[model samples]
Target: MSDTQPATSQTAAVRFEDFGLSADILRALADQGYIHPTPIQAEAIPIVLQGRDVMGAAQTGTGKTAGFSLPIIQRLLAHASTSASPARHPVRALILTPTRELADQVADNVKAYSRHTPLRSAVVFGGVDMAPQTVALRAGVEILIATPGRLLDHVQQKTLNLSQTQILVLDEADRMLDMGFLPDLQRIINLLPKQRQNLMFSATFSPDIKKLAGSFLQNPVTIEVARSNATADNVTQVLYKVEEEAKKDAVTHIIRERGLKQVIVFSNTKIGASRLSRHLEKEGIKASAIHGDKTQAERMTALEAFKQGTIEVLVATDVAARGLDIAELPCVINYDLPYNAEDYVHRIGRTGRAGASGDAISLFTDKESRQLADIEKLIKHNISRLQLSGFVPARSMDRRPRYEESEERGVQAGRGSQYGRGAYGSRKEKVDPWFLKPYEPSAPTTKADDNGGAPQSSSKPQKAKVAALLGGVPKR
Candidate 1:
């Protein structure tokens, strides 16, 4: 089944009233100026409201958050009371995210939806103190949105409880797995009650995601609003094949030439993001960097500045690229190719939101030809290669040579060194990198004792005499 075709597109445009949502929720939607349901919302809301497991796949900016959040809030309000009683148990719903920004965004949506309702929600993530989170849990919350690592930490510390959770939602599951949170996810899943409802939402689902969904969901009602890995048709995508050294110049030229404002530039690494931001700053373009390495406060400051238009360009890693709710952002630039092909969608998905036209530009060097090809394959389209004036490569048709012999030698050396014997011990055989090995502390060593006390060394006590015939000095 494809997500592109709506099962009931011919049905007259759906209103929030058609979904039979609670009065408070409908009121909130009206406050937010949402008059009609998006395609994903129109289809997924009814199925989720029925308490069935749902697997939804659609590009970002399709209102998936509201699709699930609205129903979740409605269900919670119907089953639970908001009388402000101490007996009102907390944490009925748990929403897991891959990044702190997304966690906060989800929490914001939940709060907006539940504003008129008496239900309470809180967002928790790492890189911030735990005292506030602990207090929030103690006070009781109906919905808890958290990142996986911090959630696991709370579980380990007994600061949060998930035993009473009736609904579990995994948002951006693909990105969570990509960040190596599968183990933590499994741990969290094992702690939850097995009979509770499961909702897994992702922009794209690969084979691995299907396997994970199979393990967690039972006869899920799959709702896909768009084809998997398909870029939004509303986004205009283009690429430039420039020399490695001319990328920054090309980016600057394009920004000025196109008269673009409110742009997000994606870099592969934290350092690269900072470097790009600095370069843009030197060129008199205000910019900032947001990544895992930055403190929570700093990242928030940068985000606020970007949102307020104090900064024109925001350079960021993939963590900031997902689930960002910036309205009407005009452009997204790929300064560095993503290691994962799926990330291209998430990165560019930052733009073209809310039924607005957006532009996505990619810069590729000869070294990144394979990565470019992978991106094109994932999007299932050939991105038109454009040549920017003053930034074209010196050698347009140059192909980098393959260093097969050097690669073979490096592999051989790695095998030899890893298998070679050392003074401590021999290497373990067939070590799987995926396995998490426990750490073991070594025992302390003791020197020999003399007469029940520690041994003492004598100063200049012994000397080696040289033979007289050699006429050599004595050694001590």
Candidate 2:
């Protein structure tokens, strides 16, 4: 559980039976060909089975679903009656995911693990038929996995109840915040019982996550399967410095030269993803864009096509890319680098899953130096630069931060620095030498005080020589 410890290896020697799981759960694991327990599962399971809250941090494809779900299902089954029908069971466990893809994946794993048990569970999310979700909720189940948005919709529609939920799991908590789900999470938590075991899981537990935990979780046991926000060790990061207008050419080159068969190209925005997908299509590559605007059906169809090699490339925005469980994906290309450094970690995480080797290539323009720098600092490694034969960038030498360019320069100006130089070159800090030079005020020396108290100046400087030396203010 310590941060310095190595990632929970998939090949850890621990066995599922070592944990106090039910026979049905062990049977299900054996059926799934999982004889060994992953580090997260081995470390967190016993604690979870003890009914204590847990904050789990692990990278994707690290068998985290089993880490919490196995214990949860086991605990629920321990309390369930053998004679009671599942249709009358209360929702004892609640797992909330940020995206529909993740909710479905978690639901599938829960079902698979509980295949032999008497427990029943259902998944609900947005962008699909709610009638089916409502029907499933109406039939009492022990577990409910849902996305924040769709779960709230169910609550508002009077089709679901969380008051009876005994266990709460926030899977992918960071992505939930990234997608603006904090408010929704609070609303859902308020609906749940006051005393319930809370389990929070994320690739990274940033300060915001800690604050969320403070409010929701009791004194919790922390488990770190991998360092927070750390990129997968199997992912090879590659950077390409290209002119802004030449990113299209660079993509085509990477695909043709490296013979990349299937790649997920990430963009910073939905519109950018759509544009890049169209451009790649015109460049003779089969491509499709996936983002929040696209319906869940469309996103799933595109993903399925990409997985089956029907589409060579899939372009997507950051939020839209969450919960994309693509295994053995050969490569991930950043058509545009993400604004958040942590996103770079998650973006490349899509590839290099389940201990498979993969590549993460990012296209960088000189104008995006700051965003690029942020990624390097986050992962704590500089990506190796790859200069293609025909795509040498024209402005690749500009090392200035993103704020030094165009509209952002004005913001830089407001800071301490002056243009491109050192801090505070303004006149207030260093008075102009011309004004500070030896020069007396040119005023009427003997004009008896106008009001009999003091001498007054009659006229201003005529030739403007003294005035120019005094910063255009006539000496009186």
Candidate 3:
């Protein structure tokens, strides 16, 4: 059944109390200051409560997590036990995310929603010691949130079992495919019981996602709270054309011009994210970077700092683009346009959350015209191209040395460097004086034998060179 009817204001008027959820769940919702369900939540909660499979699609910041989580908790409460034994709290609901950050965020939401109830929830992902997670798993939890790789790792270690998992949620299924987690997903899905209810939620739906749902879900109800591949209506999007070398300077200038206190600058690569973060810090802005290359603790620390207003800007890769819920983020800057058009929706979605007005500022170079066009095509509209007035480049600001140093650490020489002509910048390599010396031949000295027959060499016999084991480099 299709739940694609346009959500009117009437839906907005619907309260969470009307769902007939457990008092504990309602109490937890109240504690979080949430009363009314968002459109997606309003639609999917009831369907999920009926024990039906769900394929849910909604733009970011539409409360998709609670839409499925609240119902999953409600369904699992009937079997929830207060027993301390591990068997009493078997993992009944399992949620999988593509990245560790999203997994942890979902875990937080799940823990908050189920806190007042007897249900126990635990989250497990890589980049941390597994001892704690193993202990928690052995202690038993009714709801488990994890990434595919770590989930499989625990399974291999015999610390987790999914045969009894009665409900499955693939949050951000499209991103999982993009991150090459399809095989891991397939392996995890195979371990679960065939009769479990399935729920797949994402901001955008693609052909691969549909095929995945068809394979796993048994006639799941399709729920679309917004148009497919649509951006948030509350976000104002704009693009500025700049030279590739000037993008970092533009970012700094934008933050300064607007006096933005809380913003996330999205980069297409981890190195780019780190570099931009360093630049902002050098410009006297409190900023941090998070990406796949960062440790779980580091990423979480940066996120917590950003949320607590300790950091003004958080430069990040796509790992933080999805499932990052920051209240009234105000704005998000794109240091580099995303390679995938769908990612543009998610990147901007970091801001303008929950009906809050936000601005999405993007910096695109001439070479990224195709990426910009793709983003515009996906959103079904042209972004407002604005000129940066009264902005000065870093070179003009007499920061040419800093620019040159950053370029040296960037792309290799002879390549089309974004910052400058080459990392060396017309500098010549220094030659060592030893290499200029001419080669000379020396006559071997011989020792005369007492027999006066043939002269014996004075030098000792040289040992034959031996090859290293395992086909490694040979000894000199």
Candidate 4:
């Protein structure tokens, strides 16, 4: 019932060979250096083989793809067909992802894991021609990995059919929901046969996610490998309390000083990614930016370049958060704290992958204090402070390294608390005397003299002006 508890298979068979995986799958896994099953893999694979709905939660880099892929491949190969009809291989499995990168990644893994098997798999996503995807569909494929929008497009074109799908997998379900694909996911789910096995995988199991799983899953066995939005322990996490102006230097310095070859730096926006990349280039670092503005081809090209070690640093937005798998990536830098706290886990997950030790570095400013607090609260672990050699926060801020403590105790501006007193040094906070006083009708009395003995009512008439350009009495 709980993902934390080791499954019977987990305790019984810690190695991949003991899982009774197809020889083909075992060979493929061995080729990929996958000797041991991850916790999620060990737990979920057996349940998936039993044909049960699985709602799984784990931190990023917990081998989720293999957990689902291995069993799905085994199940498909168990019923391999010998018919020669083009439609004989009618897509029996459909994997829905929010982004094209993930679709491609999952399909590659499926193909790799099923290398020695005769199973055929194809991937379809947006940002490419429909004709090629249509051609692939016409030839027939047993497994299809796709994005929701593009799948809907193929449906509209009468080129793809989910009616025969026997299994459904929503990889990164939380991300799909984050990308606003829940309605599209529901639409796709409606197209598939309701009796098919359903599997939902995500890094976090929020209430919304549980609700989403409830709508389709048939008494799913919940597998929570880690706490919701949890990060991995293998990653060395640190926070650099930096000034806004010093962020660029901090990132470049970290990369150069650490001698990190492969790094993914996450920014809050497209412009931020581009700007940082350009700055990194000026500092002699081979960097590239990937975001929504780039075409699919361009994004793929940049990602490939980064993966190939041609691009030293991959600067990107949240679009790459759910996908962008780089094996043994050394470090991940957060140029800006994520607006959503849960994303912090996803961003750092990029580095600590495949059981490899990695580093998660974040640049923080006073402005990002709230975001930092939110991240700490969601992860339930405070990030350790890291100081840069020969680099202290610019004195303009005159602020100490902050985590959640300041945000918790600090009062709002103009309230009963310190606002800019210590940091601004010698500059007192300007108090609005008029705003401080509560509004009340003036005491009705005659106009009072300097002696404060008597008051007199002297009414001043207001001047009238034209109300329109055409000329008219403004008011009575």
The 10 consecutive residues of candidate 3 with the worst lDDT sum are: 404-413
Q: For candidate 4, write residues 217-308 as lDDT tens digits.
A: 88788788777787888999999888786898888888888899999999877767887899899989999998777888999999999989
lDDT of 4 at 302: 90
Question: Which scores greater on lDDT, model 1 or model 3?
Answer: 3
Cα lDDT tens digits for candidate 2, 1-476: 22222323345667888876778888999899988777788888888888988888888777788889999998898666554554467788999999887888889899999999878889998999999888888877889999998988998998887778899999999888877889998899989999999999888889998888888888788889777778888889888887776787788788888888799998776656777789789989899999878999999899889889999999888777888887789899998887788888888988888789999898888878999889888878788987676655343443332222111111232224322434444433445679778978764534556578776655653453444564586557
Report the Cα lDDT for candidate 3: 0.87
* Candidate closest to the true structure, highest lDDT: 3
- For each candidate in turn, the TM-score is 0.80, 0.78, 0.84, 0.80
Best by TM-score: 3
Candidate 2 displacement at residue 316 in angstroms = 1.0
- Prediction 4 TM-score vs. true: 0.80
Per-residue lDDT for 348-457 in model 3, tens only?
A: 88888888889999999989999988998999999999999988776544323232111112332143243434455654444689999999888887877999979888
Q: Model 3, residue 183: displacement in angstroms?
A: 0.5
- Whichever of 1 and 2 has more lDDT, that candidate is 1
Every candidate's lDDT: 0.83, 0.81, 0.87, 0.83
For model 1, state the Cα shift of residue 302 in Å: 0.4
Ranking of models by lDDT: 3, 4, 1, 2
How many pairs of residues in model 3 come into backbone collision? Answer: 0
Error of 2 at 328 (Å): 1.2
Write model 1 residue lDDT over 199-317, tens digit each, in one string: 99999989888888888887787888788998999999999887665677777788888877789998877766886788789988888888777898888888888899998998988
Better of 2 and 4 by lDDT: 4
